[model samples]
Target: MSDTNENKLYGLVVEFGDSNALVKAAERVRDSGYTHTDAHAPFPVHGLTEALGIRRTILPWIVLGGGLTGCIGGFMLQYWVSVSAYPLNVGGRPLNSWPSFIPVAFECTILLAGLSAMIGMIALNGLPRPHHPVFNAPNFERASGNGFFLVVEADDPQFDLQSTRALLDDLGGAAVSEVYDD
Candidate 1:
């Protein structure tokens, strides 16, 4: 039987004392061609996302699609109801009065777009996560306070335990440790 106490590694975690160090480390890691890397800080660090080669989120496109769908659906619903289901000739207005449908379409656009933004954000982030393997790293609790961390996952094609540890050490990381999977 395998020893469960022998931790299954998730990644390599390198803690930095400050955001500046973390940012520098991230840049170096990116430059070194390590793609599966992430950095964490107690608060947002300007330029750090770019340093990590992060790309723009797709949530806006998702919301736009939802809004367009809502707009079309809203307009069609009104058209069907007024022109097909109940033909009412009021004030000499046309049965398919597109002008009257604008307000409902606008409202539906806002509603669906707002809902899509919320849902897309939640889904994209993989939220409701109560746990993460990085939490197993030493002093990880400080991440919400003062710690800044950079992790290179074990699954990275370039990942090598010794080499990564050495690289993190060279990058001025403190308390470099192995992050374990549960």
Candidate 2:
């Protein structure tokens, strides 16, 4: 590929067999002044987030927005139905009864929050993509089995190809591959 293509390609990929090795590699990558790096493992590895310096996700904020929207929607729907649309006066109760609306409001709140969480996660993570350059790495298929992989993207301001490779090498990585984009 051309240099432009290579520049668009980010990160070095290092494969490992165990989570311990992956964690150590992550720490080394972080210490190497790389800011755009990721780790993948077949299973959840405790403390991996902290090692990667990953912060708590913003999903909660999205859910909160959804919940607020749902609250307003549910209240409006109920108001229109019971008062403006139908004007039912049952058992001398007020047409816009707040107590009776609680159940529907609560349910709508949860439903919208859940929907927002799913959509937010997918959008934030750029899900449903058909391809990724990392898939081109040899032996990367093992990532879904027992292998762990760490990728430090080249877009990081501190990334220098040779120096990054040497850093990974010194960290005991068995192999490091440059990722490319088309």
Per-model RMSD to reference: 2.3, 2.1
Clashing pairs in 2: 10-154, 11-152, 11-153, 11-154
Angstrom error of the Cα, residue 44, model 2: value is 2.6
TM-scores, one per candidate: 0.90, 0.91
- Ten residues in sequence with the least summed lDDT for candidate 2: 1-10
- Put down candidate 2 lDDT per residue, 74-129, tens digits, no spaces: 88899899999999889999998988998898888889999999999999889888
In model 1, which residue pairs have backbone atoms overlapping below 3 Å? none
Q: Which residue ranges in model 2 land beyond 4 Å of their true spot?
A: 1-8
Q: Candidate 1: deviation at residue 53, Å?
A: 1.3
By TM-score, who's the top model here?
A: 2
Per-residue accuracy of model 1 over 1-182 as CA lDDT, tens digit each: 12348767788899999998889899999998898999878898998999999999999999999999989999999999999998999999889999989999999999999999999999998997889888878888999999999999999899999998888889987878877886
Model 2 Cα shift for residue 37 (angstroms): 0.7
